[model samples]
Target: MTLFVALAVLAAVVSFVCSIVVWKLGLRFKLYPQIRERDVHTRPTPRLGGIAIFIGILAAFGAAWLVSSLGPDRFSLLTIVFENPAQVLSILGAALMIVLLGVADDLWDLDWMTKLAGQFIAAGLVAWQGVSIVSLPIGGISVGSSWMSAVVTVFAIVLVMNAVNFIDGLDGLVAGVTLIANGVFFIYTYLLVQQTSPFNYFNLASLIAVVLVGALAGFLPINWHPAKMFMGDAGALLVGLLMATSAIAVTGQINPAAAGIEDLFAAFIPIILPFAVLVIPLLDFGLAVLRRLRAGKSPFSADRKHLHHRLLDMGHSHLHAVLIFYAWTAVVAVGCLLTYVLPVYLGTSARWALLFIGVGFVVCAVITLAPLGRRKRLTVAAEEAPAAELPGVDELAGVPETHGPVTAEAAPVESPEPPNGAR
Candidate 1:
């Protein structure tokens, strides 16, 4: 407990300092995001926020190691770092690869396929650490691995990476969601550690999860709407890679005995847990792909058709739209937890929850499709007059146009004399 608390405080401090450094460097270098046709923001903002987040995470891990080694206890939570050196190396290496790839994309626009290929390569490296899902649980039944499981694991990684990236569209959306997700993962994995036959990998996962949350919490204030900085592809992909890898580290590996169930059930629990925790990204990925396919378009194409865009279309301001999405994410997260721990009661809770969800959807739908208002602006003179004495459109009908440059289409049609000849 002391170690974890120290880790959190250390991480927060490192993140806060790194954020300041990154902000200063970004301003100096003029590395800012320009408004693109597809972008929602109308202003230029700094784009190197990822550099701060990455540095913060690395520094936090270092601090954790130092504290574990020096705190009178020769062996500490940081032993997980040395115990699973291969896995640690794999995670760091893959994160570096993805972050660099993303930074490249931000600095010099990379093609979609290029970034996609990079993500796959990084996931493959992480998987090479013997991290792969071998089974799953469905309705209390165990499902074991075949060729299908391998394909599914790889596909899940790819989808999760994109989902995290997709949610990065709004300020604070990805950061806030990432923080929440990691916080939950930290608690879940910590509880798993307390059970008999604890997995050391889970301990390492909690450390990383807390580190991620601390970094995001430190940076979110600057990234929030009316934002001073944009995370850009650099930060988004780093987050995606970190989250997918963390999920893989926890749920993708298994110890049959630790699962505490006979047959395949034990092996399935850990496998299912990661997916359950990442329900939002997984669901968003599925919805995005389905929507694209239904539109007869490539699923990889970018547009203003994301869920966040729909919320904005519904007349919610940017911040409100983001908050609404955040609320939905929290709801899904809570639902997944309920289902996992109390599978029987989840049905009843879900039924009640669905009503509120339906109401939310309807409200957003109505706001998006509603028409503009009917009122018109008038001059101060018109406003000063009594409401009943105000001049009607008919009273000012056929008023002569004010002088201005003629439009190209009307340049040749100017009359030789005014029709009223008042001039």
Candidate 2:
């Protein structure tokens, strides 16, 4: 646990520092595209944030390799940096491949089909590296053939990969959601790794989770509302692949049968945990497809009707909408986490705790959904408002300036005229 903490911190600091460098370099290189009507940002901003995150993850992995190889053997059972070097490299290599795919999409704005081809190819690489989902529990028994497992593995990876990509509608939404999900998975995996019967200290999945949390945490400040740069498809794909890999490692490598988890869902928890953690993203993706289908539009087409966009339409502030999403994600993911954890740690009392938490989540969500008249007025004003001329430097500095004419194309789209952030 101590060693894992150090590695996580290392990744966070490295990601933070590297992101700063990437931010500046992206601006200098002018690697951003012009603003689009369907897009969020009002002004041009860099989309190379993923490159920095990937580099940070790379550095952290390197650090882990060095520490485990040189450190005393006592801690050897706690880390696989020295013991499973191939696994580490394979994970990193898979992530790197996705990053490359994301980078291409971010820069070229590739069509959906081309991007998907890259995603499947990257997912295949992951499965080939020993992180395939080898089984699925249907009844009380495991069910899968070798060929079936390969197909299921690729499909699962692609599902998560695009779920993250499709949900990248608001600033920090994907990163923040994944960060929370990663924390839950880390705790669950760490606890699993603590068992002494079959595996006293096999924490590869835990390591991946914490490292991911760190990387996302380090990037969050820059990605918060009023973002300076976007993670683009590169960061989204890379992060999603990392998350999927962690789940695959546990499900494919570790046996829940050996875990002896005392729950109705114990047999399937390994397979179920990933979906539980990613419940929100998966729901969003599913709803999006249904929505587009009902409208007779291609499922891959982009739109402004995502959940976050709906919140915005309902007159919620950007920050408020994001927080609401975060709250819902926590309630769902954490509730799912407790399903396995509280049972083990809290025993019978876990049932009452789960019930109370569930109630609290519903109440909070209900209150958040309640609308106010002020917001409706604000929305109306924003829609009806005419564009105004850009304020001069003196006006910006709070010094009075003469009125100027607003350009047709440069006019404001909203009443308050704030920067447009993409969904």
Candidate 3:
């Protein structure tokens, strides 16, 4: 308990400080990006936010190690870092690979293939550390084939890394969603730690989950709407990789005796909950790929047809669109979290809680997306005058047009996806 609280605070503070430091560095180095056609923001903002996040993770882990080694007795909670060095090294190594790749992309705008090579290499490193899936649990059957499991595990990691990169379109979208998903995963994994048999090893998954939540929480304020900094591909991929690793750890490492046959739902929860936590982004990834491929374009192509883009086209402000996406993400992840979380400790009564929360989420969605009729902006003079006093359409036509956004289109229908994940 003491270790977890201390770790969370340390990680959050380090990440927050890193964001500020990186913001300063970005300005000095001119690492931010200018406004582009497919971009949502109107102003240039820093793009090296991921640098701080990566540094924060390292600082937090170092602090944890120092604390566990120096603290007299009560701080043994983090001793797992010292005891199981392999797990800690594996995750950090993989994370470093993605962070460096992000930095390269931010600086030089690496081609998609180059960045992808980095992703596969990173995923492979983690798999080499015995972090890959070894089996699939469904009903009473245990599907085990070493080669197939390894392939599946690495592919799952890479798929999520790309999915998260795709959904990093709006300000604070990926950060907020990552926070919610990691928070739920943290709670679920912590509960599993409590329920495991006496001989179960340390819960590295829970630690990774909490560290991710802390890092993302610190990043969110700076990355919020009307943002000062964008996380670019670096932060997006790092968080996504963290999420995938945490899921793999919990699902792959559970002992068979602990997940016995009696509880069918319990047995299935390990396999289902990880993916359920990321349902929205995964769904969007699939849809986006299909939409692009059908248009005779590469699956990596970009368009303004993303869900948030549609919301903006409907006249919702930038902040509103981001909030709507946040609400929808919370609805799915939190709802799934509750279903499993409530049932474990509360038994059948968990179903009622699930029903209530599920309905509440639906209500929130309906209200968020309620019919908001288009409202015309009224000038002060127009608001004060009657219909007879209003100017005619010809009077509006007489107003001279200034140099502004172009409505003219030519060549390709959709904007090509930016190489740096800037769009």
Best by lDDT: 2
The TM-scores of all predictions, comma-separated, are 0.73, 0.84, 0.82
lDDT per residue as tens, model 1, 1-423 = 566666666666776777777777877887764556667766666766777787777877777666656743565445656566687677778778877887787777788899899988887777777555554333333335445545655676777778777766777777887777777667656655565334443266677777887878878878876666766677777777777666655663445543333223324445555555456566766787899889998777676667666665544567666666666555544444443344222323334434554565576445444422212234455678898777764333323443446676664333332111000
Indicate which candidate wins on TM-score: 2
Off by over 4 Å in 3: 70-77, 139-143, 197-202, 252-263, 371-422
Encode model 3's per-residue lDDT on 1-423: one tens digit a residue: 456656777778888888988888888888875666787666667878787788777877787777778763755555754676776788899999999999888777788779888998998888887777766554224345766767778898999898888788788888888888888778877777777633332477887888888888888888886667888889999988988988887784344455433334455556677677677678888998899999998776667677667666655666776777677667766766665566566665445545765786787666555534322333444566799776544333333333334465533234323222235
Q: By TM-score, how accurate is candidate 2?
A: 0.84
Q: What does the lDDT read for residue 338 in candidate 2? A: 75
lDDT score for candidate 3 against the true structure: 0.73
Error of 1 at 117 (Å): 0.7
Note each model's CA RMSD in angstroms: 10.2, 6.5, 7.0
Tell me how far candidate 1 lies from the true structure as C-alpha RMSD in angstroms. 10.2
Which ranges of candidate 1 are over 4 A from the true structure? 67-73, 137-151, 198-202, 252-280, 291-297, 339-423
Ranked by TM-score, the better of candidates 1 and 3 is: 3
Native RMSD of candidate 2 (Å): 6.5
Q: Give the TM-score of candidate 3.
A: 0.82
